[model samples]
Target chain A: MQETIEKVTKVVKKKRAKFPESYIHDIARAAERHDLDDDELDELVRRVKRAYERAKVEKGEAVGTVAAQSVGEPGTQMTMRTFHYAGVAELNVTLGLPRLIEIVDARKKISTPTMAIYFEDEFKNDEEFVRTIANKIGKSNVNDILQDFHVNFAEMNVVAELDETKIKDKRLDFTDIINRVEKAFKKAQIDNNILSFVPSKSNIRELRLLADKVRDLQISGVKNIGKVVIRKEEDEWVIHTEGSNLGAVLKMEGVDKVRTTTNDIHEVEKVLGIEAARNAIIHEAQRTMDEQGLTVDVRHIMLVADMMTADGSVKSIGRHGISGEKASVLARASFEETGKHLLRASIRGEIDHLTGIIENIIIGQPIPLGTGSVGVVMKHK
Target chain B: MKHEMVPDHAVLSKSESNKVLKKMDIHLEQLPKIKSDDPVAKSIGAKEGDILEITRKSSTAGKFITYRLVKD
Candidate 1:
């Protein structure tokens, strides 16, 4: 089968000359799947060549506006509210229109940040290991495992009664919690399963406050990760987190670094790179569209992603980003903050060369698009 | 970390870059940019002003090739 695939790829490369590697690979895989004979394979390559040629965009096409319209038209039909994420009632993920807007805007602090965490090959099938990881990832404070925090005025300390059932359920170590408490407070001591801590001020109010503080102390898991849902996706148990901490999650052992991803675009850029961030933008936007049952072409989303990441860093689509950075002063002034942009441009002696479509349209000149983009020079001697 | 989404990025040498610039008819500044501090750029040891060839799997084109100039 491998030999046949290689033979077919070689034939396609020679027959439909200069076909891209991806196209050749696709053709070869299709031939293998269909168990196509030589004649059928030849016809497939020919059709692919014709299709490829037809798919090419003409030079000087106004792709940006077309992409904007394509993506924007379907966006109007999306739901405006958040929804429980895929039967995980605990997680309320922003979807549809709001999510699509969030992605394009490239907001640094995205609402409902989440992560889909995969495990390493060795730990993927291990349910016990996955459950432990989920426990480790979901933030659990002292209050979660403690039955109650009592202020002991007579003893000049606060007593925190531990819930054995909760401890066992969470797979928390009794000694580990004690040690954490000891480290967090100066005079914390443990007896049986109860932890007692002396307040610094040594008063009733101080004791009450200390008990509150102790209850809020994080006993386990990575910070900012709220709730974790361990689900069976296809063959393996995957962890879905309500909050995201990509940098910390990637550092842990048995976590699949490559496959584990966060919905936070800026975080992805900070941890991975601009390229990864661009891919994230495309993935996120496409997902939002798919969830809404909208069918905007992926190329339109890809174009928007490329525009957002064209610079070294990710920028938003609106005034503070790509639109604001346009070479033409008139274009920037035309977008938003008209007075401020025009004033800044005038003070800086910025010139609007009337090169772009917006500036040309503003001055009632022929916009440099399609037939207008072509230039003709005629001279008679 | 070899993230799947990052695709394949290769640094083009001076001669190869010159060919690309000539073919595209654009200056280095006109190309899309990648920061020198970018994780992929740092991993590949790409210095500022160097050109990177990024090959991504496109939804429409099947294969897409883009160039980025590394900048601080």
Candidate 2:
């Protein structure tokens, strides 16, 4: 065993100096277990070196076009349907082509914004604790906890009758609800369990409007979050929320901040900055493609994410974003609104360097890719 | 959450960045870019046009060192 280890180490050191440390260890371990001789180990090292060299990207390769083709071809075969979340019938996630478009476009508001929230150590295994946390995160409007609403037009007042049973079920304090309403409406008065709002004008229309607004007002829980379902995913009880509020969700007591993630890219960007947003885009796109049984390389998705956020902010792939803002005038014109781009370029007296692929392609010249990327000069010796 | 996915980011000094560019035989725009507002970039106080050395753990290779040009 000692002799084999020494032989393997010597062989590894003699081979490619840039060979990864892990690969070296893997070969060394195999050599020890198999007790391979010097000749066999040398052959193995040679084969590994050849494989490594073959795996590297070639110079002058058109990576962008290849990435686009790889992803787009598989995308055409994707089904157009929203998928139901695993074991949850009501929770639907936008999947297939629609989701792919949304991700590339970097839409501010996704069709379905959701969050997968993990619990802290104490609450991870307890279903009861997880349910309580879910209820706390879910939005609670006046309609959810109100027994009745009376718009006293004659008295220029809007009175809300609170349901004690519903409030207790939600684990919300009555005074806290009243305080929130009072803060929302400056002229609000709470006597006992009756909350009254006195409007500035006594018009019936104005009083009715105030009553409507009060009915929809949020009394507790994070705003914008709709239905929250607590389900057992493997051994841990995780909370799946229909709507996403990443900033607020991360601050909750029983929530595991590290494991919680939102589907909205902009929310990730706002709360965690641009790097997290870039990773979110990559992960989301990969997940969407994977659900449809497509196998685009992760590096391709990484390239797209890098391009989208290269300018310090997430931008869509189409007009008003990456394509529209290309440094080359012709490149911008070729993407969209050709006439507008051309007019603007001419007005500004902008010159086209014709160095990029799109511009060269439009002008009937060889694009700057592959063989076209290189320049040659003949010298007589 | 912020620190979990973030790789080790270190801003290269001016001389070192220039050396990298020279060794790679590429212009600043040629290298893959990271945003100036990237959380790792911000934490290290990297400005636009600076180079960031990101060291990531890889399953195939034990460690992989990648560079990104910070862009505004």
Query: What are the lDDT figures for the candidates, one per model?
Result: 0.88, 0.82
Global lDDT of model 2: 0.82
In candidate 2, position A104 carries an lDDT of 96
Q: Name the top TM-score candidate.
A: 1
Q: What is the TM-score of chain B in candidate 2?
A: 0.88
How does residue A300 of candidate 2 score in lDDT? 85
| TM-score computed on alpha carbons, candidate 2 | 0.85
Model 1 lDDT, full chain set = 0.88
Mind giving the per-residue lDDT tens digits that candidate 1 earns over A3-70? 77588677777785567666767777888899899999888888887887788788998899999999
- List, in order, the clash count of every candidate structure: 0, 0
In candidate 2, stretches whose alpha carbon ends up further than 4 angstroms from where it belongs are A1-13, A17-39, A82-87, A148-159, A186-189, A197-200, A378-381, B1-3, B29-37, B47-49, B57-63, B70-72
**Candidate No. with top DockQ:** 1
Ten contiguous residues minimizing lDDT sum, candidate 1 chain A: A82-91
